[model samples]
Target chain A: MLQTDQLKFAYTGGDTFSFPDISCERGAHWLLLGQSGSGKTTFLHLLGGLLSPKSGAIRLEGTDMAQLSGPALDRFRGRHIGIIFQKAHFVNALTVGENLALAQELAGVPVDNGRIAKLLDRLNVGQKIHRKPDRLSVGEQQRVAIARALVNSPELILADEPTSALDDENCEQVLHLLTEQAASVKATLLIVTHDGRLKDKIPNQIRLDS
Target chain B: MNILQLSWKNLINKPLSMLLSTILFALGVGLVSLIMLLNKQLDQQFARNLEGIDMVIGAKGSPLQLVLSSIYHLDAPTGNINIGEAKAFLRPEHPLINRAIPLSLGDSYRGYRIVGTNHNIIDHYGAEISEGKIWEAPLEVTIGSRVAEREGLKIGDTFYSTHGLDINEDLEHDDAGAFRVVGILQPGGTVIDQLILTAAESIWEVHDHAPAPVGAAPAEEEHDHEAGEEHAEGEEHTEATHAAPATDIPLHERVDKDITAILVNFKARNAMTLNLPRTINENTNLMAANPSYEISKLFDQLGLGEQVLRWLAYIIIGVSFLSIFISLFNSLKDRKYELAIMRTLGASPGKLFLLIIFEGLLLAVLGYILGILLSHVGIEMIGQFVKKADRYGFTGKTFLPGEGWLFLGALFVGLLAAVIPAWQARQTDIHDTLAEG
Candidate 1:
């Protein structure tokens, strides 16, 4: 359902391409592994509609995301995309449910308390609905971020160093949650990480320099 | 997430920055709100005072000053006219003339001044007594509700009159006389609350039979000494003193002789537009000032006075908008990877742009809420100070927003400020941002 062609992108007012041709397709647990400044993150952004490729096209359910404008693209992204970051990007002022509710609202979906409650339950942090992100532990916060990302039931999941701050045991649990949720939705999963420990478990990886 | 979620996240991401922005927005909008409240209350007050009268004729001085003093009770009176001269103009056959209620003011009981007038004053003003009927005769008084309450002066409470504008001894010509609060008038929300309403006979009576202080000498013997002294000095002094026209006879014994100004009400539609006021001013030593005209003139300098303040508020609001723009723009640079990741997940660059724009919109909504709250509180605070000053006698104590449309405009500006920055974020290159992720 998701595919990226030989995507090429360059920064405005600069001659250098940030990354070379990047390609991705659904049904694989893909990992963009590279050293810092090696363009692995750049490759992930290319697949993500956040950056338009100068010489490539990205197709999500056969519609090019790079060409849409304004609210149309926003609604499209809200419904079809779920992103996780290294740091939990939960809104600090909002309680956990409110944060997730915000995500649901932005995606043009009604706030389904049942789904959100179940997600928080599966994450084993059901009691923290009213707690703000700042008051949560690092592991707990990451769980909230993961819940927010998957809450919209998008067809694609993107995580950037999502498990870096987790303890070894929590890291395994978080990664398992990301992969399992993506599989449940039949969504494509992409992890941009320098964490080599993930390679053996995913069985499919895309090294940025390869 | 769309605008609400994304915008909320941005605001929460940096708690300190968001707080600062909200505070700035509140200040910008609060000033404008305060001015509106003041204008509304003061204008309401000015309009109330202008009611029930067409023209105010007073001692020849600045017409503005006369209106302010007679009607508003805020500025100095132009001059005091003699009752004989003022009544002489009331010819029985005059065509444009209607009821002329002469107002003689000088003495005050406690903090409120005594306004000497005939029953025509009560009839014209229709001031129903909140507690008792209107004053019956001279030396009788009708007090306003505020005055009665503040001074604890009930219907029979008698307070000694101090001569001149206030309760002081500087211009102490008479201090023995007193005004008995005869009636308490209803709350009219005008300058009348600070007035002591009585007949012109009351003022003449207060001056008459004014008890001499505890002393050995008497007034008739003293007058002989003054007359003997002036006579010995020159025959010219004797002539001038005699020329005073029986002014020595305390006229209250025969008739009321001290009407400071006559407020004339004419039925002619164009009476105020042309001849009457000019005739009154030109023919007599008294000056005629139109209350509506002068009061409106006070508010006419709006381009700089009120408008400038509003413009300054707009500029402040603009600055806040720019601040939101800059903050969102900076966050955009930082969220490049985040946006890129969302894009890869199938969020189009357009979606990303919308997300950013929506974030801006959210910030504006938040700022607007805070600004409106601050405005309400600000008006309340202003009301407190104005109540304390009691200079202009504004009746209400709450900050009431008069122009709801203007408030909506402010809200729109706040939203626009937030959206611009968020929109700018959507324009960032997802391809490049994801690379750095």
Candidate 2:
């Protein structure tokens, strides 16, 4: 469900910051590891359709990511791709459930309270639904972001250095939850990070040149 | 859950700043709306009485004052033109000089000042008498609805005049003539209702002779009870020298002189091509003023106050916009990861752009609603103050909604101010924010 061919990438205004060819199939779990400034986040941004390729094409479920525009890209991203930022940012003014509800509304989806409740319960962030991210613990915020990402059951999941601040045990738990969510959706999961400790947890891995 | 709640919540997060901005927006539009409303009401008030006998040739102090006092009854008139000189000026080719109504002021009956206009003021100017006929002379009178209600006068009732611009109780110093309330005029929503209507002859006749007996009042030849009775009671009826009607003349003709002003009308208003300039400089003693031009010039002279208020209002609005901008701009530093998280959630940059702009548009609309409400309430408060000052003989209540354009304009300005920041959000780099996070 994911395809790339001769996918060389470069920053639009610069000669450096290029990415080598890489491709992954549906349900594949992979970790992209690199040192700081090695462009792991940039490559993940490209995979997530958050950045347009300078010279490569990204296809997901036979649809070219470059072909979508405006609301189409938004809709495609809403139902088929989910991302967990390193810090689990949220609309701080809103409660957890409302944040989830907004993702659905901005994506033009129906509000499904039952599903949201079940997702919150599974992520262990159920009681925090009525609270804003600013008031929640860091772990709770991470779980809330996970619930938001899985709320729409997207086809692909991407995370950008989401476990850097956690202890080894908590990092393992978050990684397990991320993998479990990807499994439930039958999605391909790609995680970008500079840490090497998580290398053994995933079967497939790509290392970027420093 | 939708954009609206998010917007409201965002604004509520910083109450002090939100309030400051709202006040700024309110001030910008509020002042402009106030001036426009007052100007419109005053203009309508001025235009209403600008009817009939086409020229006003008074002693030229300020024609506006002459017009205001004589026609609109707002101030003391520039002193009266000599009755003889006014009539002589009408001898020119102006056909519409068809009639004259010399107004005589300077006395008050209860807070309503008594004006001496031609008795023909009723028919000629369409002052419909709801009760009785027009007064025939100075001592005979008519009251407008407002005057009648305030003083409680009716036909056959009489009242004595006090000596100034407003109500006073020097009844012993009152004029010897007790004005008969011959008529009570209807409500015309014009300056007429605030006035005590009387013939111009009555004004001149009432003040023309001092210590004059009431029986010898002008135009009383047909109705003076004392003259008729004394004529019958004595064989030497001519002995009461002052007990005769001064003239059996019509009200305007009885004046036998120039009017307070000449109200000129063209055979057609388009006749101004030949008349405007000639009319402006035609007489050495009189100056023809274009009402609109003069008012505009007056606005130019007083432009400082208007500009200060206008800019103050705009600056307040500008500050409001900046407040909104600052709120969002500061919030941007806090929301980097969240925005990046939205990006990973497949949320397009365009949706994020809408979020900021939506907040601004909502703030502006709320501020607009509050501002309009404040303006109406403010004007009503002013009206009350004016009405209570009615003791000074001013009609003090006027505020209207035709001035909505000012508020609408402020709202549009706010919408435009939000565009830049919104565009910046749309173009933000998800990688930078996410990487930083």
Candidate 3:
């Protein structure tokens, strides 16, 4: 479960953007709708604890993430949040399997190769585990990214413009995989995007004003 | 998955840059290390030969050349000193002098110097005979260990001496007396090991006369050779000439003899003995040179060139450090995003900092190991040429203790080159970098 109250942020010398409060329970999926410059990505980043809000409480399972800082905050985010970006990026030096193993290690959990293989098999990216990210196809790369994000079975899943680069068929397949994986892990899912195709996919909605 | 593994992967990813940095570092280290090894080995050789003897009394010229020729046998002597003037200190019962060993040079066989000195020289060098007995008369030679092994000279072998201290065929004294090897010295690891020893009277006997009938005498000496026949033959020839055994004639009754030098040791290093070199240099025509002083001055002169080379080696190392800094800095620019992504995946800023440092350290350690190996191999190859040319016995098989400091110095260079890049990695703005994508 996740909740936020009057979250505000500002880039250096830029105008402040105030975000609305939102409460989501376990295993629920939501689409955060916005136009360009609407600060939806900023809101998702705040919820993921990548950026601390200026003045607000972002409570995830009863702890205010805005109060955490430094290594504690980094470890908290790794253990509790899964983030997916529009373009699938990875540490290019590592293979797919190694990237997942790094994610588990950074999250302070013992590396579980069996769980990683099982998750990759479920996402249909099992064959690409030993391949470098650059050698994987776009859709396959996206699936591997999803597997990395969900490897820790985090409590909250955040996707920032997840389907902006994908075609309709691949976009639909990715959205289905994201929701189904979130449900299996019993995590709250929030997808932030300007893409209108995702509006009909999830009923729970939060929209940011430009 | 670990930081070290990730650092290794990143280093090998750009193999060309890594190879360039490593080779540059290795070249600098190898050059510096080779200079040190050569300096140490040459110093050991010089010091070994210079032990015990206080001063060298020879014909006046360059003091360094006198020490080199008389002590090391590595140069031409500064002409010969007359024994009439030098015998003042060469007397066995001289009050100020503990012992004086005469060296009469100018003849060599197979490039090894044939030194004509008495048994006092053998006792001074602690050279024990490994085979046969010491030479008791003229033309009865006792060869050094290295001379014996190199020329295959054994007891009773006869070889003719050359005119100078070289292996020139034109200088062969075919009409002169042939030196019969009466003994072979043990491997004493001193200058004596490279010499062929005989009584100093032999040198005078050989040069004072011309065309002795001993040309055919070597074949007859070899077949019926006994110690008595050789000694009697040598004594009969020396007795016929004015160059008699040095001890038989009293110091005041001696004739003028042409000896090259006298290696003198004082009973005590006091004012009288210390002042002897200045007194001899000023009053007498012979030059008295302190071996240790001349050797140190020689090293100082050679140290100038060594210092310049050492500075050059350090400059090369500094330039290599710069190259390493540039390589690490440039690669960080390309890896900024990857670093930010690592932060987002829960890697702390400290981890990113350590990762960059680890990469730099890996390069340095690799370069250092390669450099040490290259230097020893280079020295071994150079040692072969030096051994063939001057026979100084240079070797690269031993490692110096200072190389441990060099290892630390190399690691310090690695850490120094990595500091800025690692600091930048630690300061990486995760939000901005991730959002730029």
Candidate 4:
């Protein structure tokens, strides 16, 4: 389970955002809907422990993320949360399987190549595990990125505009794959996006105002 | 993957930049190491042989040339000195001198010099006979260990002498009877190791019958001219001369005798003996040069060139550090997003910092290993070309103790070159970088 109450954040001498409170049970799917400049990405970063909030409590599985800092917070995030960015960026020097292995290594967990292969096969990217992220097609790279995120079997999956760069057909397929993979891992999935095509893809939604 | 593996992968990803930095660093290290090796070996050879002997009495010429020729056998002797004049220091009753070993030069057997000296010269260098007996008769030769090994001359083997030190010149003394190898010395690691030893009478006998108007002129014609002058002096002094067997006459009585140099050791380091070189240089025709003084002066001159080369090597290392810095800095700029992604994957800022440092360290370590190998190979080639392999007797196989310090210095250079770039990598703004991407 993941929950946030009145999460607030501000960039240095820039816009401040006060996010709406949201709570989700384990393995639940939620769409965090927002227009451009609504600070949806900021809220997602604060929830993922990538950014510290000005004032709020982001509790993930009963632990407040705001209380942890430095390596401890980074480790906790690695063990319990998974994040996917919009553009499906990766360490271009590593192959797909190596990227997944790096994620497990950084999390201080013993890497399981079998789990990695199974996850990629579930995402229909089993054949691309040996390929570099750059050499893969955009859809294939996105699927590989999904495998990297779920490789650690975290408790929460945070996707920030992951489908914004995809076409309509890819957007639908990726949404279906994200929910299926999240359910298999029994993880709470929250997708933050400004793409309107994903409006009806998930019934549960939370909207951010300008 | 571990941070070290990540660093390695990143370096291999951009092979050109890594190779350029590594090669630049290696060249600088190689040059500096070569100079260090050469300087250390030269000092060892000079110091080892220059021990015990105090002054070299020879013909008036460059003092350094006299030391090099008489002590190191690395150059031609400066003409020759008359044995009558040099015999003053050779007397056992002399107050200032303890031992004086006279050397007669101007002949070689296949490029190795045949030094005509007494048995005291063998004891002077701490040489032991490995085979056969010492040369007691004229024309009987005792070859040094190196000469014996290289010429393959054993006891009872006979070889003819050439006119001068050079082997390229075919000024063979066919008229002179072949000198028999009577003894072989154990390796003493001195100039004596490359010489063929005999009594002073053998050199006189060899040149006494040498036919005039030789085939090829020796490089220093003054040697032959001085020998002729001594022969002329001998004819005026005695009737029992060149036709008489060389073994029949004593060395001191033969006024026709001319020695190349005399290696003198002082009885005590008193003011009189300390001033002996100056007194002999000013009071006599024979020039006296202190071996240590001349060797230090030689080093002072060589030190200047070594200092310049060391500075050049340092400058090259500095440029290589800069190259490494630029390469890492540029790569950091390009990999900002990926570094942020690593952060998201639970790589701490400190981890990123170590990653960059490891990358720099890997390159430096590679350069250092290659550099040391390059320097030894370079020195080996130079040793072969300069004929120092057997003569001065140093090889590239030697590893100096100072190289351990050099290794630490290279690692420091790597750490220094990576500081700023690693700092920037540590300060990577994860949220902003991810948002931008």
Model 2 Cα RMSD, 1 decimal: 6.3
Winner on DockQ (1 vs 3): 3
lDDT of 3 by residue, A48-119 (tens): 888988898999999899999999999999898988887778888889999999999988989999999999
Please provide TM-scores computed only on chain A for all of the candidate models, following their numbering. Answer: 0.91, 0.94, 0.98, 0.97
lDDT of 4 by residue, B167-254 (tens): 7445877665578888999988888888999988777766765665354333224334344443443342122233334454545555
lDDT of 1 by residue, B1-437 (tens): 45555556667778877777767677777767667776887788788778867788888878888888788777656666765566544543446666667777666665567787766666676677788778764456888777777778887776666656655654343443456677999977667776788766666555443433333122111211222221233223112232222333333232334456777777565735367788777887778888888878877965368898888987887888777777777876666655554543345456666666665565666666676677666666666676555556433346454536555765576557656654565565544444333
Lowest summed lDDT across 10 adjacent residues in model 2 chain A is found at A3-12
RMSD after CA superposition, every candidate: 8.0, 6.3, 5.0, 3.7
lDDT of 3 by residue, B1-437 (tens): 78999999889978999999999899888878888898998899899888888999998899988899899998888877767888777787899888888888877898999898878899899889899999876778998898888778888888777767768766666544677889999998888888999887676556544333343222111221221232334333423342334444543234356678889888989999889999999998999999999999989999999999999999989998998899999998888877877887888999999998998898889988889899999888888886566477877799998888889999999999999999999999977777778
Best by DockQ: 4
Residue pairs in candidate 4 whose N, alpha carbon or C atoms collide under 3 angstroms: none
| Candidate 4, position B196, lDDT | 93
Q: What is candidate 2's lDDT per residue for A122-192, written digit by digit as tens?
A: 99889988987799998898999888888888788888887888999999999999999889978898898
Model 1 chain B lDDT-worst window of ten: B216-225
DockQ scores for all predicted structures: 0.25, 0.48, 0.69, 0.82
Compare candidates 1 and 4 on DockQ and give the better one.
Answer: 4
